[model samples]
Target: MRNFALLAAGALSLAAVATVAQGVEDPYIWLEEIEGTRALDQVKAWNKSTEELLAQDPKLASYQSRARAILDDEQQIATPDRIMGDLVANLWRDAKNPRGIWRVSPLAAYRAGKPAWRTIIDVDALGKSEKQSWVWHGADCLAPAYTRCLVSLSPGGTDADVVREFDLSSGKFVDGGFVVPESKNTAAWVDADTLLLVGDFGPDSLTASGYGRIAKLWKRGTPLSAATTVLEGTKTDVSVSPFARQDGDRRWTFLTRGKTFWTSDVSLLTKDGKVVKTPLPEDASFEDIIDGRLIAKLQSPLTVGGTTLPEGAIVAYGLADIEAGRSVAPELVMAPTKTQAIEEVAASENILWVKALDDVSGKLFALRRSDDGRWTQAATALPDNSTVRLLETAGKSDTAFAIVEGMLTPPTLYAVTASGTPAKVQSLPAKFDAATMTVEQKFATSKDGTRIPYFLVRKKGVSGAVPSLIHAYGGFRAAQTPGYLTGQPYRAGPLGMFWVEEGNAYVLANIRGGGEYGPEWHKSVLRENRQKSFDDLHAVAEDLIRTGVSAKGKIGISGRSNGGVLVGAALTQRPDLYSAVISGSPLHDMKRYSKLLAGASWVGEYGDPDVAGDWAFMSKYSPYQQLKPGVKYPAVFFYSSTKDDRVHPGHARKMAARLNEYGNRFYFHEYLEGGHSVGADHAEDAHRAALLMAYLKRELGGKK
Candidate 1:
């Protein structure tokens, strides 16, 4: 088993391990030495070569400047977070404030072009004062009275972060307040003097998947070590999280025991630290509590009290029934169709809002319960073919916010209510000229007869063999939705200005293993059926060529993270499909992925390789293991961060080394920091994006 072998070889030495359980020799394992002197030297050499190659592009300066300008644009929307004191909170980053500022304004003030903002914390200033990187991870405050909150800050943008209690009114960390040292952990407020803590408790306190195994109730004015453990999970379980929910006059504490990525167990915690197991479906996701009802989203079919509810439905049970251990019927709030999926479910005091997707487009609906115990719903008047997101919801009021945007439509913010017309509150100025371009939705038939949907953006009348780029992320139930350059730090304006306006086209594929069609769609391509995603992507490229949207040798593809692995498979399995590929923050060596940082946590998504059956399928398609000597692959560009603790930079490193050994044309770049994303700040992101755009233009012959 690669998992056991990797652990035996030490978590950091996948490259040094001579043989896995199968006795298979891995020659490039030395590249897995992330910080070894030899590995660092190799990374430096690769970075030099990549910089030289990209520096030769004549448009590099222009590309970088344009990207920087757009990233620093001031007309962007200030996304709202309805926090304590009825204020709208926004974390803003621009050229003037690269590290960003956490600021808040009144709802009406935030809607103006120049809001009167009061800065709570300046990350750059904090980093200077504290003499640390101090990247903001976010803050969770006491609900209803959100003045006192726990602030989570990472040293350098890693998953782990240190938590500290801060007072919003004073803009200062509370003296002698709660503070937890850096580790993968979480803390939620239970009351003014009590907190639900889940974090490292020294030896044998963490799961094999690298998450806290125990839930402890910590009281104020006491050492963290003295906290009492209320719930404990096994080392093999995925994770255990603790939280407290309030509904009207009742407050309930619970623990979510994650048995795997797809299954979980729920337990109620008593005031005396007793754990009470609750009977519920293993795949049901606890959404929220409102009106003394516990709402859950079902990932699998559930039958309760003579009524069977289908998968992908929202159901609710009375909190009293759950706590009383009595069998009760659940009220079905909503159900999804084959082409429709529930994107989000939230509650605002008395109203329940559901964000649903129909054929990859977004719609908003409001649901209400009648006295007869039936639910009535109505769709919002949001425009079609756009992405609608629930921005903020009030727990004690009837106020909510939703933002709607599309490929060509600029983002518009709306103030939504349970039974009134949605009012437009704000809108973002268009960053690029999209009047001449058109958006089209098309489908490509995959090898198994599945209709794969994809979005195409191109200039009017442009056709047949134009420089094109197709992108998709087909894992993790993360649906690829239609969006404009909204509050996102990375704007699509650069793509439209530097590519589409210059006679290039872009495509977004909605393939299997994503939640566009909900859980069933994602489950269809798990583990052994992973190739279905590759097939779906390949089919889209083929359709582009067949339908005159693109031509052979004129297309380019790009993806990061999981999508990077998809691009690697496409480059290795079908080299002639594209002219170039950008594999950023990729996972190419599947045999040893579980051994790397955060890789073990994802075994539930990708089955454990220690099992022979799982490895058989994984090894067959692993890009690093499948590279051939004379396959004539296209010139691939591999980019990543040396400090990426999630995927491990070793994946891209070893893959590039193997490609070099096979004498294939390729380029590589590795930055020393920035974690999995390969960028620490807006400036770093702009530069990396510029390099990608330049590489695409050079390889695909786009306008300079």
Candidate 2:
């Protein structure tokens, strides 16, 4: 927005959601009309005005050029996406291919840096041929042979995408193959002829959150209507998605319904032609099945067969035991510590890979199960301050690819196997010179005396306070860690490259509501406690000021989506601390947030505003509702994409309009397309980045 992996009432129509004000007098409600002519006209005007302000800077073109070059650098590694034996596939995007291309290359040739890549699908070429702006969502293929594949393409980058069957070997879409029309859906291949699907079947098919609640088994050569319902969930549920796990010749299919954002109901379609539900806690997450054992992560303390596993513990259960209707007895795999939390867990046929955050630094380890079924871990020698993650696992193979990189280091792809140490396969070329830059881990005490960690990146040999920018996401249990700012136009890392290169400091805060420390770190900031996340951001800014790292009024905050709320709250609550705010695809107008696109699904995180109790706490800090007259707020820039079906652009639009009504000054911009990322192509991204650079420079007094 995989932040594509990234969600109102009962499937509310756009028109109905836009019109319902929930008893609040919203004069700017007209902006909620997503595609309404008047609303779009106003958006155009605001975009123009923001452009005019940023264009006043003489170096706007230069800034944009630098940003575009870094984003489109051809020297960047063609990261392996799906690995199948000797053949590897990836989505490649560069100057020539803006939309990207799904291509395959031989493993040996690829490792040698000269691979014969077969273009399975040239997205830019296909878009030109079809006269449509098709953004490549992804491609899922059958394992082993990997000839047949399902390709998803989004129109203008919406969450809803068209799924079509393609021939991976032939590099062509099958003429009489399967196709699902544009809708938010989940699909998995049970076999070549059978697919388990959860998508918009029709009017009553989708849940209240606009995701499919009904799961069906679709057979080849039959109408989608002919598919039989395999499972179903309530409309109030977040959604039901299909997941398939394969080991050797055995494959198990399951449907997981999100009872809430934090809970799930896992139903397995057994080989005996029976559907069985696994009795797991509402706060537990099923990681995957490995070697006939069920792997799960606990978010809270759970008593399983008289053994209570602490929160953030990784445990295993016998698949046969779970399916046999026996009391769920499990084996403890990994326990939690105050400073350690399991960030990722994935398994190949033979080895289990786990990536954990120890004091905000990434550590990788491999696990092996003994004959007695007890698992032991072997810690890897990967350096600290880096984000290590598994990229892809080959079918029935003991090998997988892992990416390792940090704030100042370029991302390198490594091939990990059960036998030996990880070997580097490819490394991304350095985008910016880091000789002058330095990275440091720092702590800030929040309002409740809770210790918060953040990464501070800046030029070395600095004596006095400097202008600083802080980027953070304090929601959704998504752990924010150190990584290079080198993907999408907004490869937002805890630390930024261009800003640090300019001698201005960059801060990446690991505030509450993130999975940095564990489930409790995120759970501590949910619903009524949401304001604490905002307070954590303020604490970081104050800490910087107190430490003489950044002076008062020399600080700035930037966040997109959930991060948007953080900066927005800071503007209204602690405006005097920061000098500028950039809120992108943010959530404001807390009262109407539930009715907006995909807003209802997030009620578990933000709480239901329609409820009087929820609104009591929300209204106190809702930036839009808290906007007052004659308050000296800092320089603010709000951006959102009209085509972003996930987070409604109205959040940014209505907030800016309210500020304008109060005669408060702010910068607002809206892109007609570009989906959740805000811009589609390099030009659009460069333009936006240029504006951001100019705005930050002017407002923060950075000599750029």
Top candidate when judged by TM-score against the true structure:
2
lDDT per residue for candidate 1 within 1-704, as digits (tens), equals: 11221222232343334344457577667678888997787777767766766777787888778778877887667777544446777888888787778888875555443467899989889999999987778877776667888888988877778999999889999999999888889887878888888998886998877888899989999999999888888987878888777665566788988888778898877655567776658878888777878788888888776788888899888877767767767789898887798978877778788888999999898888888888888888888888888877755556567899987788888877666468777787786777889988999999999999998888988856787888787888888887763222122235535677678888888989889998898889888889999999999999999998898888888767888778888998888888888888898888888888777777777788888989999887888888887787777778888778788889998887666655565677787767786777777777776677777877788432
Q: What's the C-alpha lDDT at position 566 in model 1?
A: 87
lDDT, model 2, position 26: 74
Tens digit per residue, CA lDDT, model 2, 1-704: 00000001111223333444555477678788999997887777767667776787898888788778876888777887877656889899888999998899987787566778888899999999999899988888887678998899998988989999999767789998999889998889888899999899988887788899999999999999999997889988889999887766777788898988888888778766467887667678888778887788989988866768899998887777767777677688888678998988887888877889899888887888899877788887766678887677654556667788888898887777676477777788777777778888999999999999998988888879999989888999888887885441143321256577678888889999989999999999999999899889999999999999999879989989988777888889987888888888998888898888788898989899899999999898888889887886775788888999988899898787666654456777788778898777776777677788788887888442
Instruction: List runs of model 1 lying over 4 Å from the truth.
Output: 1-24, 111-115, 485-493, 702-704
The C-alpha TM-scores of every prediction are: 0.93, 0.94
TM-score of 1: 0.93
Alpha-carbon local distance difference test for all models: 0.79, 0.81
Worst 10 residues of 2 by lDDT: 1-10
Residue 360 miss distance in model 2 (angstroms): 0.9
10 residues in a row with least lDDT, candidate 1: 1-10
